[model samples]
Target: MGERTRLKRILRGLERRYGKIEPPPKRKGLPLIVATILSQNTTDLTAIRAYEALLERFPPARRSRPRRNLPRDSDGRIDKIKIRMVHVADARGEPNWRAIEKAPLSVVRNCLRVCGLAETKTRALRSLLKALRKETGGYSLERFLAGCDTDQALDKLSALPGIGVKTAAVTLAEGFGADLCPVDTHVHRVSGRLGVVSPSGGRNGTFRELRKILPPGTAHAFHHLFLSHGRAVCTARRPKCDSCPIRPDCERRGLEEV
Candidate 1:
């Protein structure tokens, strides 16, 4: 079969196996961004715990305590005071960016240590948060990503102290659902096994080649789907080839042998 035909088969089989792609849980922007950073070289469960712990320690609104039942105005309407009260109260007990910003590096590092990549990721997280505060005037993650294209976003994120291509792509894919593929170790390995790209090339080549082959708007979903499939079925050590939905196409391509 032609290379293009094989790839089309692979994509269709993947869709059959995984069903339609769903957006990951919608989380507040900063925490989601932090969690994506922390997920580097770690398991999802571990990353989630670390993210929750960090948020517990440093909620997004730390400047003032939340108030309840403010007095009404002469019109008997709960005015701006009530609005602020509601906003604060709703935000009460959530992660505060101010607290995170003010936290000692050691504390921040320790908090992230639980997620894995303690040494490297801590520095990245701290640097990113610091830059966010300095550059954006606050922890406005939406503002930070605003007006940036996928490539621009990737460049901006990878320019941070410890963030790299994989981390940036993952963050953008997960945090903003941007249309970019994140070729991590798993995606790289699995893509090679499926003969989508040559095994001789490294992750960068695989990313570039796959980016060329896949349809433009679906790259983000395809990235997540590939990662999830890698974790769930196409594992590194021993892929469940027999049970895989794409086994026929893979076998035809000698992917299992590879």
Candidate 2:
């Protein structure tokens, strides 16, 4: 079978094994960006706790709501939505990035201590928000979502401090639902073992290869399901290959001894 066809079959098998996977609820750009940064070098549970801590540390500034909800159309006519007007920071529960930017680095780092790599991640987050403000005149990546194509978006995000292709790809996939696959440790391992992509160039290389052939509309589910499969079965050490759902498709690269 062609590579793409084989990948589709594998994806289907994964779906069957895990039951249909879905992306997390969409997060606003800045919060998602911060959360992705926290997710590095940690489990999702830990990352979530650290995210919550960060929010609690730098809670949103209270803003009075409009006296009445704005009608969708006072005249009962729908109007075209303007992408520029979408400021994700204005969303309820979003932390005050400006507050974060002005706070001491140690304070922010303490909030992320639970997730590990607190100093590094804290530095990255502060730098990223500051850079966003300078570059976009605000603290949101919504412009990338509204304006850039997948590749362009990836380039822009990857250039940010404390962000690599993995984090950038994730922000795009999870936050904006862009059609790009990110190669985290699980994804890199599973894809290589499944013979979907050669593992020569590490995560970024695997990500590039996967982008070329991952079936369209499958990026989000592919990422989550692959992550689940890797963690549960195709783990870094002593993977449960014998009963793995996609065993038929696996090349078992680097697993001969196991």
Candidate 3:
């Protein structure tokens, strides 16, 4: 069978085994960005805990005054308000990003210590927030989210500090429900093993190839289902090929020794 046909069959099997995949509720802008960054190299549960700790430690600040008569910055080049007035309450009262930007690195790192690469993540957070403020005059991604060009939006997002193609694709996928498949470890492994895509170029290459063949409007489901399959049945150490729903269709590449 053609790779595309096999992929469709595998999708059906995965859906039968795991149930219909639902797109997560839309989470735009900063909160989604922060969550994505926190999730790096860590389990989703651990990332949640770290994000919660961060929110608790640096709770949302009181709403800023109206922007009708906004003030200028120190440089006085623009009329950008020193405080972020918009989108502050969008996260059901998101953590005070301004506080995070100014907080000592050690303090922020402590909040994220539960996750991997705490120090690196801390620096990234600070740099990311600051860069957003400078670039957009606030901690907001509405501009990218609202853009008509997907590639342009991806480029802008990927240019941010500590964000790569995977992160950018994930942000667009989860945050705005964009038609982009993020190639993480799970997606990379599962797709490769299933023979849907060659893994010769690693995650980035797999991502590019997968996008070319992914069925229309199925990126969200494809990502979630493959990720679930990888985690539960096609695991790295000991995949349960015997019980795998897609076993019949999977190539089982690199599993002979396993």
Model 2 Cα lDDT, one tens digit per residue, 51-169: 76877888778843423221233555321111011112223246778989999988988899999999889888988888888878888778544678878888887887788888888
Better of 1 and 3 by lDDT: 3
Question: Residue by residue across 1-258, what tens digits does model 1's lDDT show?
Answer: 487777667667777776666664433456555666777777655665676677667755444443334335679754321121112222332467677768787887788878777878877877888888988998777788799998898898888898888777766765677776789887887788777787677887887788788765677666756765777678776677877877776633334434
| Global lDDT of model 2 | 0.75
lDDT of each: 0.68, 0.75, 0.75
Error of 1 at 187 (Å): 1.1
Worst 10 residues of 2 by lDDT: 79-88
TM-score of each predicted structure versus truth: 0.78, 0.82, 0.82
Off by over 4 Å in 1: 1-4, 23-28, 62-94, 251-258
The superposed Cα distance between candidate 1 and the true structure at residue 170, in angstroms, equals 1.9
Residue 202, model 1: lDDT of: 89
